[model samples]
Target chain A: MSAVAQAPGPARFCLVLLRRQLTLAVRRPIEIGNPLLFFAMVVALFPLGLGPAPDQLAGFAPGILWIIALLSNLLTSDTVFRSDFEDGSLEQLLLAPQPLFLSVLAYIGAHWLLTGLLLALVSPVFALMLNLSAPAVGVLVASLLLGTAVLSLVGGIGAALTVGLKRGGMLISLLILPFYMPVLIFGSAAVRNAVLGIPATPYLAIIAAMLCLAIALAPLAIAAGLRISVDA
Target chain B: MWSFFHKLGSPPWLYRIAGTILRWLLPVTIVALCVGVTWGLLYTAPDFRQGNSYRIIYIHVPAAAVALAGYYVMAIAGAVSLIWKMKMADVAMKSCAPIGAALTFIALVTGSIWGKPTWGTWWVWDARITSMLILLFLYLGVVALYEAYDNKEAAGKACAVLTLVGMVNIPIIYKSVDWWYSLHQPASIKMTGDTTIDPSMLYPLLLMIASFYALFTCCLLMNMRAEILEREARTGWVKKLALGYRS
Candidate 1:
């Protein structure tokens, strides 16, 4: 009762929510593994479809890697708020003293950590599988690290909007995929520039700018979406 | 002003006002469109470089410009609905989607047709064209999102948030795509070079663009009138209107 009477500050609430999400995600190791597995399988499939020629694969490697990263992030984002909404914890969070803006960011932050963070870490292996140059592999990872965070944040808007729907899986893609284009464009451009032995810093800077913008703005939409979805 | 705004919130008043405006504006828009098209296509001199093919600009440019502007209209309407909880703004936003999508489709198709004559292909990965394609996708996404929700009120709100998000992203998308295109292709065929247009060609093009805006308004009002009727079917005013009662 005393703890309930003295509510935590917004920052503390966000950290608590972040920890809770990570702990829940960590409990289900398969969930964390699924996007990575998806990424690897897709990367392997591209070689078959586009021909197994090393140079060709290497030529297209940057785009192929960034696209797979975006898709994997898309797949995981739908579940960020689904379980909480299904279990009514989302409602509790809505009723909490803290503003939903920070709370929503915490959810997206945990999501980025689990999916985007891990994918960027392992992408160099996939980059090599596609015969991407060693210099470009570093840029691929850096771009994905920055780019997928924006994807996760934007995807959170779709996830929150459709979290209450029975058939939100396919619809979520239709809703948010357009918003994902800028990130994909800049992210892949950065890697492509590195592959061509040109400076990739400008593309990376643009992506970083997009990430900053998304971090500031996306949660407002996500929080509003959650409210509308829950209310409906 | 406040009274007018308050009156604007009344569905019956808006429906009647939209109908009244459409009664005069629709014919004017159609006539203006026909005049602009004929003048641009027949009266204007053939371009020295492209001949008659360049005249497609009358349709292509106007559609593309209005298609882009319609998004801002939708976003602003969405913002009004979100902030003011104005149901009319929701209807306005909802109505903008299909009109905007159709205009975007026109722009893309006309651009493709024009490209065949000028660029020697049906399409090119030019930045503006690609951005227009993405704009079409964005409009369709909004329409799809709106239809997916079972509850119409919530659907309006959800689509509103999506539009606002897209509004923020549109500039970034355009900039990034522009940079990406410039990086990949170095100064290929410019869509429109800096050559000064003759006033003879420019006047009709300006007229077409103006008429396109008028066309957009007409379509929006008609769509809104239908939406208001469907939504307000149970209201006495709508019932009276349907029964042909003037009052």
Candidate 2:
């Protein structure tokens, strides 16, 4: 029983971290909703700018949605470490006894849950509005589910790297957006494949592979970046 | 052997050695570059298909190759700095970015020129060219990140992590873009591989490639020397060097 109790230590720490992050996010509802709002507004602008031609909008829908999702994720990710760093919680996290890696994961997981997951959930409405085919909507959601996790993970690295900078607003995007290109390419490709009546499984699998890679490697970078920022 | 690495960590030793290497390397690079360019331009026969436009390969291919290789050099230096906390490695890593960016820019411009003549467009989103462009952005990102931070030490560590991350992504980006390009269009630039070039053309191309590498080394060393001097401006060796210049 004691061994069982001790074994959940890492899990418990991660949960507490996740809960803390989510609670903080909940307290600031506007911040939590900003990415989704951006997603919707950007999605709306496409139709307005490109015209009401349903076929043209539908043809562009996958790329458009994926690009907007990428942007929202990029923008929100800048704040992931900012508040903590500014308030000195990041310093405490660095000096804490538990592994910084798991805590960093929990922070990034909360970010994804708040921003990317919400974006994926709301993407279908925009997808339908953009006239994306019904079959492709599921692929869009799945791609976002996997792709945004990768984005949050990768973007967390950029955020951690730039958190110490005073004017990191635009720099984080410049740093991480190129990294987002692959996710965008594969995610949109998956949706496009589904729209064309082809199998999107391969692209989704690649995204999954990317997610696995990010999960295994990105926290180390986040941990390193956090330490560097804290030291700064 | 271990002592040599420890010596490498010393800024003055590195500064002096880099100067010695540049003394011999710079002239060799310039002479080879001139010879290679003259040979490539005047000596090689025009392509039956591309005509004179094909001569740009001597510049384009070498620039692209060196640009890609420079990223690895920068990343390796970043890794060294991160792992060993070697300040000279940080200097080397910092110096590599702008030079790499410049080379990548050259590759893109020359490729664009080559494209206008061969493909009748300034750009076509070809796989190699697209990847090279991304490489330029990656270099610029590192430079921007380094400059954004007020703390130089922390900036070094951050840039190190970013460069390592970029290094891991380069192969994936290259492959994905290659796949993307192939899917969208047939192989457009077949001037190099579809048909083998004669020895007459290949020789100067090889020389140009070698000289370009030497050029990269020279530029990298010179950049590192300048960076070291600036970074150690208040140090004794630099102060003495500055006084000597003044005297």
Candidate 3:
């Protein structure tokens, strides 16, 4: 879709923005990989500290993985608009004729694809390393896939709000982690249910509902936040 | 009627009115608090099972109730600020964070103290306590966001947005904490449900909760008065007020 570089239509603009974000992210392999590495290192620390008891490790794996994923996503989101904001591109985007809501969606979409999707993809390896049972791995990956998208969307609100601030690194976490708790709760619960051979669909359904709510609402907040941050 | 609404926008009017209201309301709040605390602490019958330790309920329940109510107050002030661009509402919203955080902290401390005597532990990640902890974080988050911005107006707008977002999430957070607790722990202790206790105990609790609400209002007005003075210090009215106070 982005290959067709015609007149800058709204759809084309969004596509271009998404493609630009992905391309920029791809160029910075280290930035893209930091969260994954954080994920792995934190997961590795668990076994070292908690002992190699498989049952205990497996029980905590779902919560540990979900929490680390939440943290990594939170960390990555703080930079979502930081560079654009600093370079004055964010102001241009704000001044553009395009709807800010759509542009914000594209930014958040690109972020989710880069950090959340990648995190979900690599979560199975972490799941195995943590000695999670085989059946729960599917639920683990599925929950992350859905849940991390919500984190990125919700986290985008905090990112947009703090993007203009000098010391947003720590403040973004405080602003967004309260919003992340429900996602973390349901995500891990789904996997725990899976590990126990119980029904996980209900928890997954709640997570999907959360994703839908975030998708419908978060961009509006993100747009408002960006406006405020830019004005600041 | 609408003149009163218009008057709310004027800082000096709000300051004067808040001062007048506080002059009456503050003493009433203090007296009510003393009466409620005394009634609950001494005049009421103790819990059949937990003895005098259960008396912590008076402070704990009111603090927790008022803390939860304080979020609504904060969020509603935030909404008013955002919707109407009311400077006074922004002042009210900003003033609310520290008071709410302090109340939430009191709730948490009292809950922990009560837990030590009842549950035999100083802390438990009980659903209510965990929710209170999250609420404290939410309050502190607003305060932090406000302080982080150099531009005061932008800080108010940003905090308003964040508060609105937190408002939407509060119910979900409460539900999830409840569900999480139910799944992980057996229902070892039942918190005060509706109408379970005798009227003797419940009366003092109701009085305490009512007084706590009054206390919250008094604190909110006092804080807003302070904020208005701080913001308007350079203005003519505030300068006159300051000279008058000094003289």
Interface RMSD per candidate (angstroms): 0.8, 0.7, 0.4
Backbone clash pairs in model 1 (N, Cα, C under 3 Å; residues 3+ apart or in different chains), count: 0
Candidate 1 lDDT for residue B13: 89
What's the number of clashes in each of the models? 0, 0, 0
Q: Which residue pairs clash within candidate 2? A: none
Could you tell me the TM-score of chain B in model 1?
0.98
Best by TM-score: 1
Candidate 1 stretches greater than 4 Å from native: A1-5
Worst ten in a row by lDDT for model 3 chain A? A1-10
Q: List the residue pairs that clash in candidate 1.
A: none
Predicted complex 2: DockQ = 0.80
User: Where does model 2 sit among the CAPRI classes?
Assistant: high
lDDT of each: 0.93, 0.91, 0.92
Chain A only, candidate 1, TM-score: 0.97
TM-scores for all candidates? Answer: 0.98, 0.97, 0.97
lDDT of 2 at A180: 86
